[model samples]
Target: MAHFNKAFQFKTRSIIVLLTVFGFQLTAQNWDVPADKKAKNSYIKFDKTTASEGEGIYTKNCASCHGNPSKGNVLKSLKPTPPDLASSGTQKLTDGELFYILNTGRGLMPSFKDVLSESDRWKVIAYVRSFNKSYVQVLSNTDPTKSDKVKVTMVYNHETNTVRVQVVAKEQNTSLPLKDAEVLLFAKRYFGKLPIEKGLKTDESGVANFVYPKDLPGNKLGEVELLVKVNDEVYGEVESSTKLKIGIPTDKPGLTQQRAIWGVLAKAPYWIIALYLLGIATFGVFVLYLVKNLFDFWKKGQQ
Candidate 1:
C-alpha cells in the first residue's frame, strides 16, 4: 500500500509539472488578436495569378527564413525557428489569424504591415495557401468597389487633445453612418505609420475618438500627417490621409546639416577631410617610391 501511494504521488507531481509548463507556453505565445481582426477576410480573391504574384513577393521577402514551402529547410538558428508554411501547423491557421500574425509580429518576426501593400500581403497569403491541397478560401462578402464611396473625416480638438473620426458611406444621394466599425489611427513617419493608440470601435453615431500625444513632433509649420483606416462589415475598408496643424513645431536641424565625421561628403568636417586627403597622398607617394626602387633594381639586374 505504501508503494502504491508513492507511485500515485509521483504520477500526480509529474502531471502538475507538465500542466504548469504547458500553461506557461500558452501565455508566452498568446497574440491576443481582437475578435474582429481574427474574423477579417481577404477582399481579394485567391487565384492562380495572385498565388504566382505572391510567390515572387514571398521569394523576395519571406524565403530568407521560412525557406521554400514544404522543403523543410527553415532557418534553425533562430530562437523560435520559423515554421514551414506547408506544414499542418501553419496550414491549420485561419486566413484572418494568419493575417493578424503577419501584421502583429512577435519575438524574432518583424511586422510586415508597413513593408508590404495590402494587396501584396494578401497575395503572399495566397502563395502560402497554395501549398495546402485541402485548403479552401472563403472570400469576403464586402465589395471592394463600395470602399471608394466611403468617406472618412477627422476633427482635432485643442482642449481635449483628441481626434474625432467620422466614417460614412455614400449610397447614391444617401449618406449612412458606419457604426461598430474597426478604426485605427496612425501618424505618418519616415519609415512607417506609428500607431497612435490601440484600435477603437465606432460608437452608435459612427464616430471613434483617439487621444493624440502632446509631445509628438511635427514639421516646422506644426503640421502632422494623420492616417485613418476603417474596416467595416458593410463598407469593407476605407483609408483617409489628412494634414493637421496640431503637432509641436520642431525646427531641429538635420543630422548632416553641420560638419561632422558622419555627415555627407560636402558637409564633412574640414579637418577630417584634410586628414583623408593626406592619407591618400601619402599612400600615393609610398607607391611611387616602391615603383621607382623596383625599376632601379630591374635596371641594375639588366646591366
Candidate 2:
C-alpha cells in the first residue's frame, strides 16, 4: 500500500511539472502567429467600392488612433500608442502580416475579431494603405477564377534597364495574343496610380514596353510592383502584378526631406535660432521703450 501511494504521488508530481512548463512556454511565446496564418493570401481584392466602404468602417472604428492625419488617432496618448499605419515602416509589411495583425491585436491595439467582421477588417487595411502611394492596391473583381484565367509575363532587361510586359487574353482554354487591347502600366505610388506614360494599346505581339529607370524609388525592401492591366469591354478587365528590384527605397524620408507641422527649437539651425531669439528680445525692448515714452508724454500733458 505504501509503494502504491509513492507511485501515485510521483505520477501526480510529474503531471504538475509538465503542466507548469507548458504554461510557461505559452507565456513566453510573445503571441506569435503560426507559419500557416502568416502565409495566407488575402481573398479581398482592391476596389473603389470596397475601399470606400473600408474608409467608412475605418472612420467608425479606427480613425481615433490610425485613420486621419490630423484626427487619425484619439488614442495617441495611449501607453503604447498606435503607429501611423500609412508610414513607411508599417507599409513595408506584407498583406498577410497586416492581416494577421488585424486578426489578433497586440499591446494597445484591441482585437477586432470580436468587434468587426473579418471582411470589414480587411477593408480598413485598404483604407489605411491609401494614405501612401507605394501601398496603393490594385482593384479587381472578387471573382478568383477571372484572375486565374488571365496570364501576365514580365521580363527585365539588365542592359537597357527596361521592363517588357506581355499580357495574353485567355479564352476557351486556349492561349491567344491579345492585340490592340487597352493596356496601362501602373507603378504603385503612395496615394494613386502613376501611369508609366500615357495608356497605350498593345501591339500585334500583345507586348508593351516600359523604360524602367534605375533611380525609381521603391519600398523598404528595394522592390516595386509593376501592375499590368488589360481593360476589355466584353472579355472583362484583367490584371497581373510583377515585382522588380528598383534599388533605393522612396518610402523612407531623409532628414532634410521631413516636413514639420510643429517646429521645435532643437531642429532649427544654430544661427537661425540665435537670430530668432535676438529678434524677439529686440521687439520686447522696443515695446518697453515705447511704453515708457508714452508714460512720459502723459505725465507732461497732466502738468
Top of the candidates by TM-score: 1
Q: List the residue pairs that clash in candidate 1.
A: none
| True lDDT of residue 84, candidate 1 | 90
lDDT tens digits, residues 1-303, model 2? 999999999999999999998766444233466664454444576567777899899878877777473344546566555667776666766666777888788766778887987678778777766666656554333344454566778888888876777777677877877676667788787667677766667778878777776777887788888888875433445888888876467668544444333336666666777788999999999999999999999999999
Alpha carbon deviation, residue 184, candidate 2 (Å): 43
Candidate 1 residue 81 C-alpha distance from true site, Å: 4.3
In terms of lDDT, the best-performing candidate is 1
Q: What is the TM-score of each candidate against the true structure?
A: 0.61, 0.34
For model 1, how does the per-residue alpha-carbon lDDT over 1-303 read when each residue is reduced to its tens digit? Answer: 999999999999999999998767544365678777788889888989999999999999989999999999988787677889899988888899889988878888789999998789999999999999899899987776788998999999999999999998888899888889899999997568999999999998789999999999887888889999898986787889999998899897646678978878899999989999999999999999999999999999999
* Runs in model 1 lying further than 4 Å from the true structure: 1-31, 48-81, 107-117, 130-134, 141-155, 165-182, 187-195, 201-207, 213-243, 248-262, 269-275, 290-303
Candidate 1 structure, TM-score to reference:
0.61
Count of backbone clashes, every candidate in sequence:
0, 10
Q: Tell how far residue 189 is off in model 2, in angstroms.
A: 50
